[model samples]
Target: MKKVVELRCGSVDYFGIGAINRFEGIMEQYRKRGITRAGIVTGKNSYRLSGAWDVVKPVLDKTTMEYIHFDGITPNPTVDQIDEAVNLLKDIEPQLIIGIGGGSAIDASKVVAVLLKNTGKTARDIYTGRFKPFEALPTVSINLTHGTGSEVDRYAVATIPEEYDKSGAAADCMYPEYAIDDPGLMLSLPGKEVLYTSLDALNHLVEAATTKLSSPYTVMLAKEGISLIHRWLPRALNDPADLEARYWLLYASVLGGIAIDCAVVHITHPLEHTLSAFRPELEHGFGLTILLPSVIRAIYPAAGRTLSEILKPVVPNLKGTPEEAEEAASALKDWIGGLGVTQGLSDVGFSEDDLPELLKYLRKSQGESGSLSLAPLPVTDELIIRIYRESL
Candidate 1:
């Protein structure tokens, strides 16, 4: 086995076959640390549907720790909703906050934790570059979905609806105290969810590996994540009951998260953020599906070699040299179509008429000093417009 040593973030992670069974033990650890009250943040139905709530409730009851359930979070959570959660958290004044669900819930929990401690900083203040908190309430992240890697990372993304912006904040304090990733919880996901969420992980890996900041360690992690997603996502989608497939995909998501934490995601994430920010109803993975192929084509000249290497394990029959960017783009487009996600912007209720407004949002989200600057090539308004039109 290949062995390497690198400095990782401080979050304690627990995984494997029956890792989630240790949920109560983790809660107990917090309780022993003098946590008197706790809050559970999650989505409307995912907490119960994924059976995480069933496992967590008894622990709170048995430990006799006062707890509140904040289940109002939605996909691509808005600034207002996060403020609402923060207000509740302030009222409850929980000693600990546990985020259980997909990326949105976890991210919302992170911001809530930060804003709760930094009473002067509002959600709007954080998003608008007005305030940056240096501390946050202790947090534990329980991941129900295998994508987003929000469990172990220090990134929290939120949409500012009034400004038509979706942005991410990163701080050392944003990292969770513990991240619980249990594949067993993933078995309850619908097939489409399996595909979409896995795709999100795959995108994270690709974007992280291709960014200018990628290092040898991060690249290796990204490659492994891509290979696992390519192999296991289809199987998990075909058979939702397949624990092995779910386990591997969850593993891949963890790798993807780590890779992005080290190297960071580039163009694809910002573009997807624009979509979800405008249409809060858009599933992140679906927006990625529509834009990724075109974005690949646009950036192939600068990112060709990395893209080729990343896709090689996915498409074994892939031909052409690494410099032939179009070859890699073509193969990736075909693979995405094979996964049954061929809808364009038109399919997602977007049209040529929406392009001007979309470009405005894109410019705001992908400003020169923002995440878009990390793209392999300089991302411009003209290029973004072209990519959006192509995706349509």
Candidate 2:
């Protein structure tokens, strides 16, 4: 028999609510671990919406540790932005880093933490997956948004601006030492932004469950996230101030992130990333919510049997044979389409004129991204173009 090697699982410390006034108490737990100075990273919009500055300021002020603030982090962080943050961090020189806001800020902080230690390496170097795991700066992420799970994952996604392409870096080293989930911050999120992120988390669960690398551990994460999303996402959408609904969605988001570490995203994310890079106005979650149904239809034949076997009880009308499974998967796609995210590319303002170039970029770009290879089927530039055309 061939030997199978099991990867070691790591631990995460989660602090839910009371984080605003009790942050100092949480830090006391980490203080003995040789932590000192800390840096705060957030985006301008999130800082204003969450009132994070007011909440975090007093915590830092009371601590003996020096605080450095970097507000340059942007949504869908780019390689240049990361490099710029690295340069700034060299000047600030903190031992610990706290990322406050959405996944973008947290992801940017993860890049900043690792890049600051490497000094000379570019984001591409890490993207290549060749770097040895190094001890990262002690980091904690305060999550404001309900998706992207940057709090738990070692992955940091950044766009390489010169190429107008996305790249990701993953190493166990980049996982935050602590994560705080506060529902209070989510109360201020715009209704559309909340729905966008909620859909993003839903896609994460669906894709992770269907991905080839899925295992027992990731399956549980994916299932719980999906179930919770189905249960509470609508409540959250209808009542933004419902802290209970927000908590459920937020926890579901973390579950999805943990699923990524175990099973990873396959098709929807890559296609959506391509769309977002090509058109910045299209929101990331909207991209996934739109493209996912199509991608699901494409991959159903290959993966449907396994999915049906797993989802028959949980997903209505999915059971028995491969053909049945395929039908069930298709039905699920229809249900998702009911969510109003299946709008064609044209609906989103994408013209046919953009197809050839975007398809070319996807084909060439797939060579550099591991996520593309994870698709259920072997993908080609022609295949990607066809999908785009169908989406239109």
Candidate 3:
């Protein structure tokens, strides 16, 4: 049996099978500091359903930590939703915040933690980088899913439904004070939840490994994450209760999050944000998986060597040359398709007609901590259209 590992990136991560047990000590230490009031963020059912709340609630109660629970974080968290969360917590003036669930809940918590401190700032202020946050309430991220890496990173994404704007904001103040990543909490996940979240982690490694901003450290992190996901995602899917599989994937996902935190993702994430924002029902990982092949094709001229090397677990023997970009792209497409996510943009309710507005929302958020510019190749409107059309 592998022992739990404690790592400190942006937060102290207690990682392994029984990692949630660390939460008690975390709560006790925080209570010693006299920071007891907490504004908790979570998806409606996930906190309790994932078994994190059972472990956490007792700890909070034991420490006399009064908390106002906001179990309202939704998939692809919206600006309006975050604003509502801020309104709910304004009176409580929580000295600390707890985000339970996957990336969406944690990302929302990061935003709310800052908003509670910079009382006048809204989602708009942070997402657009119109104003930067210098301080935020300390945060504790109890990550339930093996994807999104929101537990350890300082980036948070929120969408504006009315404007079709989904923007990511990064700041030093947004890092959580503590994070708990226990695979035991992930056993209750449904099959599709397991599948999509694994793909989300895979895509994180994919984009982080290939982007122009990638470094040896980023590639090393992305490589291990990609290999771990390749090995464990299928096992976990076959047996949802596979604790060992869940453990590795959870570790890989944290590596993905840390890799992207150091460098960042390319066109896929930015465009997926637009797609899911345009069609609110669309899942973020499914959208990213669909765009992966097309985006890989666009980036392979520059990133082919690293991508080919990292993807060898699935792609087998391959010369990491610009010439085999199509082959690499096709292998990834088939691999993701085999896993049951065979949807294109049009299949998910996007059309060329929507492209105009999609690009509009995309351009609006560009150059504000923009990932498009960091892509291996220049991201032109023509190339962007081609990638979308190919994904469709």
* Per-model TM values vs. the true structure: 0.95, 0.90, 0.96
- lDDT of each residue in 208-315, candidate 2, tens digit only: 766767666666776677778777877887888888998889888888887777777887887777777777667888788777656765666677754554444346
Backbone clashes in model 1: 0
Best by lDDT: 3
Clashing pairs in 3: none
Query: In candidate 1, which residue pairs get closer than 3 Å at backbone N, Cα or C atoms, i.e. clash?
Result: none
Clashes of each: 0, 0, 0
Alpha-carbon RMSD to native, per candidate: 2.8, 2.8, 4.2
Q: What C-alpha lDDT does candidate 3 achieve relative to the native structure?
A: 0.86
List of clashing residue pairs for candidate 2: none
In candidate 2, position 358 carries an lDDT of: 76
Q: What is the TM-score ranking, best to worst?
A: 3, 1, 2
Off by over 4 Å in 1: 1-7, 317-323, 366-369
Q: What is the lDDT of residue 40 in candidate 2?
A: 77
Q: Please, what are the lDDT tens digits per residue for candidate 1 over residues 156-241?
A: 88988877788888888999999999998888888878988899999888888777777677778877899999898888878899
Model 3 segments more than 4 A misplaced: 1-8, 367-369
Model 3 reaches what TM-score against the true structure? 0.96
TM-score of 2: 0.90
Task: Rate residue 343 of model 3 by lDDT.
Answer: 83
